[model samples]
Target: MSSTTTSITCTGLTFGWPDGTPVLDGLDLSVGPGRTGLIGLNGTGKSTLLKLIAGELTPLGGAVRVTGELGHLPQNLTLDTSLRVDEALGVADARAALHAIEAGDAAEEHFTAIGDDWDVEERARATLDQLGLVGVGLDRTVGEVSGGESVLLRLAALLLARPDVLLLDEPTNDLDREARQRLYAAVSAWPGVLVVVSHDRELLGLVDRIADLRPDGVHWYGGNLDAYEEAVAAEQEAAERMVRVAEADVKRQRRELTESQSKLAKRVRYGNKMSANKREPKIVMNQRKRDAQVSGAKHRLLHEQRLEDAKERLDEAAEAVRDDAEIRVDLPFTAVPPGRRVLTLRDVELRCGARATLDVHGPERIALLGRNGSGKSTLLRTIAGGLPAVAGEVETHVPVRSLPQRLDVLDDDLSLVENVARLAPEATNNRVRAQLARFLFKGARADRTVGTLSGGERFRATLAAVMLAEPAPQLLMLDEPTNNLDMASVRQLVAALGSYEGALIVAGHDVPFLRDIGVTRWLRLDGELNPVDPEEV
Candidate 1:
């Protein structure tokens, strides 16, 4: 918990994947005590940088230096189902040793194991409780807890270790509202050198600073996400102004060069005419012509150099501006009348044995909230007709499409156009290509195999395929739509869904994102589907 020392530093760091795709090249960074939020678009090496710092990955070049012990929580956490909570917390041995010593065992090994950490069990329990794991006993097995609980449990283990530095990657991806609050509290209280890579806006808001990773390197910004955005916006505005001024300067230089050339030519013609009319000596005429030619050449060179300088300035100004593209589309056919019935659940029994009867009218946007393994996804699949209901009936009055969390709707071997064409068999290839372009996969990008696309690109492609299907799906169901997406892609998804006029049933734990997308109704799925207030969620 000391705050006076540097925790992590990388000097001339470089790394690349096995396929020779360069990620970080000669990158340098240093971190001190307090929390720093690491953010960037998908495939920008945010996670990769964390791994390098944690020594989980060895850099191809340069060196990483850590001042103290470090602990890391990966994005995709997996634990043995048979592992006990104490074992996962890394305190099982110490706890057993302490109990054995108390039971009158004089074994030197137990004493040695207990060492100076005689209060390990108490610390572990306190850490777990701090993370909102009140009822989860240390003796409980990993399989007895939910996925969100597992995440917090792992974090508890790291906290118990009391390392001087910590790294967390997307720690709140599957956490519900209450669990997220617990995480926010933990982050706010962390006193060590903490660097977290996340797209969760609320989580990022707790950080003391932001580290934006780019192709060139990492750029530091003061304050949290909102401050960083405001600063960047102001910078972009100034850059644009500079570009405009540079452009005008270039235009003026070009015009002046053209006018000067015209005047020089006219003067040369007049001088020649006067010299010939006056019948001057041949040597004098030749000297005058040579002088005129030299003067014209010098004038042209000066103007051309000025024009080149202006162009270079313009190029630099343009580079300062960020021009990231956004997805914009119009799906008029997907709209439905307010009074039209879109879906009906007649005593429908979910795959998890939950029964619910409900009617969805028009384009009602519903936000499904639940903890991990609460069957939010199961209900969505059942409604989408991807899964058979255990009992009762699910009736859909319009075309339904589901975008699963796994994004398995598209074939990896096929191109984006081909995938969309497969979903909409009636649409011609040209039409499909045109629609795909609207999703930001223009021309050749649409032809690239899905396997070649990045995580964000794949999500966009999957969304495009589902939304562009034939009959124009009037009912769309999405499961954990924001999982693993970068902030930019999340914004793009929100924008795209904003334009969607279809009935939406999105199951996700991202509360801020759900609110931003304008959810008309909020429903919580526990043992049954029931309406809940947005504030409760």
Candidate 2:
């Protein structure tokens, strides 16, 4: 591997979990310089493959080769709370070395630590400012920054390192609209091998190619996500057409087999009658009867073979079509009548120094838009009674439930069924199981413990617990609901929300998702809550 070039290669890669669940087996991949969006449904090993390439995970039976320095920003980010911002950006040691040299220490080790990077602090601050972190100071501790800011800070460290190859797993999970745009600018201008594993459609649209990880292997699409989607749609259409043709062929073959059998039966009856009437000599009649029997057998076998071949073709064609199921939601019990007062906020002060005052009526859907630390989540928590307001009044006329971004509402040891039962105590076990099925947890899936579920699966379980509560929440609030979900799971969430007739307050940066859920009101939380048009954001 040459340091001058940038690339990633995996040959004969095979990996499995400790439980012996195979993910990638005998796989081969080559990613060259450019942005590549690695995408697939949940549990398809998109994240696993990225981890393997980034050396976070070792393959069981293969090798991974990289040509240049690499940097990786994982989905779940953790930073030491006591570390200063400059330390978190990986410039503290260099800054210390520079200071020692300036103080006339004349130490060889300080020079070695500083290297040619004497202005490390300036570069680190510049990187932070590039990612919309101007307000975050160099001396501020990691604990003082918001979660979204922490994500950007990690990215800033990666930028300062200036690796030739970059890997980001769900990089925009916590970014607000403004922060995401800044990150997008960085991705667009990146001049190296950049591979991102994400479900953010806007982020994926910035890639030069699409790497779709499936059960078979990696399928490469020549362009961005939109192009990939178009190619897939065209392929599916052709596959469905072939399936229809194969089905018709099967039907035709079955008809021919039936017709052939009927003809053979008639011929046998005629021959038997002739023999009985002695129309020909006994030896001749016997010979004719044997010949007819052999012919009929050959005809029957040929038709059966044709039908079998057609059915096989049909099965193959059907396999090409995806069967990603959507959630089935029917929550008549959660509906709020028109003109009903659902919630009211009067001069309420939030934990993040934001104030709000509003009245939510009927089944109005509101989108709470804001920057990373603008107090959107705080306002929702105050309304849900999870947090107390510093000033003013908050009231709700109906049962309310809030699904926070952390999704910590469920007990890890409990199964989906048990968790739903805990929430909806009055509902029978049978009834709860039936509702769980609507959330796409059927049979044994419903019995799987929450701890063992994937990110998407756990989200569904949490959503079920809240939506299926005993009194049936007429007012439902969600904080960053689409943060960790795959595209399929996002769609499933939209489908589930389609059936909810309650007043909704959703806080997040996913405007497309908000639009898909039919949000009627758009509000921004930036020190003060105010209404805004959807297009302006």
Candidate 3:
């Protein structure tokens, strides 16, 4: 690590994805040598910015200069298959160069850059201990670890390299709350220039400053997420006031100029009727000319200036503009047609693996509650006709659509439009585009591969396809719709679900979201379904 403090500075640096819309515009940011959390909505280029700083991506314009060694975890992690935890930190590369140096090979420069380690296994074991993987065998295979565990191991590998600058993207997405706490604690103790892109509000609150990258440009506030939001909110109000004042001044000036012009025309016409010898003095004529130019020209100038000022104000105010008026999509038939036999689960027992049984019934917004691997997903899968029951009967209505948590229903290799089109083979591209627009995926965005979309976008697109089917599914099964959504986006989704008709059997652990969406039925993962509780579900 560099002894001197390292910093990341960008000047007019901007970039976007390959063959994608412009995500950044003339962005400038100066990051001090400390942990700074990146905050932004989808397609805001937060992930792209991290890649620029870490040297994975070259800026399209200007520069991104980081004065230190850098290491990064991309948004997705692809591990070296079956590699032991101890051997995963590029130690083999470190050792091979050491051997080459001793043999008088051309790896001299590599040896100079990477110090010869005492022993590869020793170094790897030490890194594993530091990362809270204390008792796990150093030689354990990566394939044996769980998804969250694998994430922790990958992060540990990056941390072991001891880069002067560390960039992490959505580091906590797969980990549990406790694991996130453990990682955060380690980050707090590290002495490096840290840059992280994440949507976790708690993580955002821990940063030194918050940088928001919107479509317009990039802006940073020297505070936490809450403070940044408050500042942005204040700017929104100030910008609105600026626009209103400029508009009022323009209106007032134009009206006065119109009246003044009328008077001037009358004066000029009357003066022409007078005899040349008897006309007013030259001084009066000059004064009148001066008055006309002052009022008329001043009006034009002020009017033009105000128009420009108003446009600028509008641009700034657009950051938090409430264009999406909370139009409560009033459900045409808010209540489902009460059928005596909505669903029938006869002695149906769901056993995911070694243990776990979950049973539930119809017209229910049943919330399947559990931690990771608690059989919630397995139970929901069976309900959606994904898994075969061991020994039971499960019956549901026709035309059923399910927005699974992972969207297993969606074809990863297919484009979003194609995936939606599978349900209606005759659906034209224009029709598919219109349906996708309601969920905000519109146009070319719908043409992107379904596997490439972020979690939230995928969920929205899946939900859109679900609701737009020919015979709208009377029974909708949603499994953790709010899992990857940011707070604002989650709220928007809850509103959409609230407006949805049909029988919803949502499986989520978000109690507050369940209450807000008017869920009346609750099903515990361990037992049969029950009515929603006033206090807890």
Which lDDT tens digits does candidate 3 get at residues 1-537? Answer: 445544788888877556565656678887767778776666567777887878887888878887777888876677876786656766756665656766778655666645656465566677667665666675578776655567778888787688888888877655654567777776777787888877666677778888776766667788788898799888777767766765665566666656766776776665555425557787777777677667766766666665666556556555445333221333343336555344556566666442333333334555555443445666667767888667677776545677875566788778888888887677788877776766777567888876666656666767777676656676777876765565566767877777776777766645667777887656555444334455653
lDDT of each: 0.88, 0.90, 0.67
**Superior candidate under TM-score, 2 versus 3:** 2
lDDT of 3 at 433: 76
Error of 3 at 275 (Å): 14
Model 2 bad stretches (over 4 Å): 1-6, 19-22, 426-429
Clashing pairs in 3: none
The model with the greater TM-score, 1 or 3, is: 1
Candidate 2, residues 156-223: lDDT per residue as tens digits?
99999999999999899879988999999999999888999888999999999999888888999999
Q: Candidate 3, residue 454: CA error in Å?
A: 5.1
lDDT of 1 by residue, 380-480 (tens): 88888788998888999999999987788999988788899998999998889889988888888788788756566777899999999987889999887
Count of clashes in candidate 2: 0
lDDT of 2: 0.90
Which candidate should be chosen as best, given TM-score against the real structure? 2
Q: What is the C-alpha RMSD of each candidate to the true structure, in Å?
A: 3.1, 2.1, 6.4
Weakest 10 consecutive residues, lDDT, candidate 1? 450-459
Name the candidate, 1 or 3, with the larger lDDT value.
1
